[model samples]
Target: MKLTIYFDGQFYAGLVEIETSDCYYAYRHLFGKEPKNEEVLYFVNHELLGLIENKSGSATRSSEVKQRPINPKRLQRLAAKESQKTSLSTKAELALKQSYEEKKKKKQMNKREFMEQQKTHKRQLKIMKRKAKHKGR
Candidate 1:
């Protein structure tokens, strides 16, 4: 698991990446202002897991194989390189897009079902009114 926090024009955001077995999952969280260390720590300690389970659905398959343990000096250099880069990862971006599309599809389906129910309700009311008219009420 890795978490990258960066300023995203309008607000500060954190992108979390998790890899398990062969599947990759990513989640984004927005902080309206720059978050303090304490706040970030609290979120990670308390809410992170629940958010992951609730919001994560689709997983992107990664093709790269895991590497063997690196030399201490080489690992330090790699960490420095990573710190200098602030852009979000492409895999994370793709995961976010897929999640958005899934939500949109669900919203449209619910709207269609609601409209169908309303139509049936109106038809039932009309039938009752016609029956009352015929009985001279």
Candidate 2:
């Protein structure tokens, strides 16, 4: 797992990436203001896992073969290179977009079902009113 925190025009945000055997998961969290080290540490320690479990809906699959552990110096260099990049990873962006689309589709389906239910309820009420009118005549 890796967390990248950066200032995003208006607010500070963190992008978390978790890579498993064949799947990759990404989650974004908005911190609003620049977070202090302690705050970031607290979030990682206390809230990160729960948030991942609850909100992580989509995972992207990668076909890359696993490699042996890297040398310490090479790992340090790679970390430095990553720190220089200010934007989120493309894979993370795609995963987030997919999750958003899934949520939107689910919401639309729920709304349609609710509207159908309301229509049926109104029709039932109308039939009852008509029956009462016929009885009065």
lDDT of 2 by residue, 30-118 (tens): 88888999989989999898988895645777665455899999999999999998765568897898899999999999999999999
**TM-score, one value per model:** 0.46, 0.46
* Residue 113, candidate 1: alpha-carbon lDDT: 100
Which pairs in model 1 have colliding backbones?
A: none
Cα lDDT of candidate 2 equals 0.88
lDDT per residue (tens digit) for residues 1-137 in model 1: 89899888879998888888887788888877989999899879987899788956456776654568989999899999999987655788978988999999999999999999999999999999999999999
Give candidate 1 regions above 4 Å deviation.
55-58, 64-137
lDDT of each: 0.86, 0.88
In model 2, what lDDT does residue 34 have?
83
Task: Using lDDT, give the best candidate's number.
Answer: 2
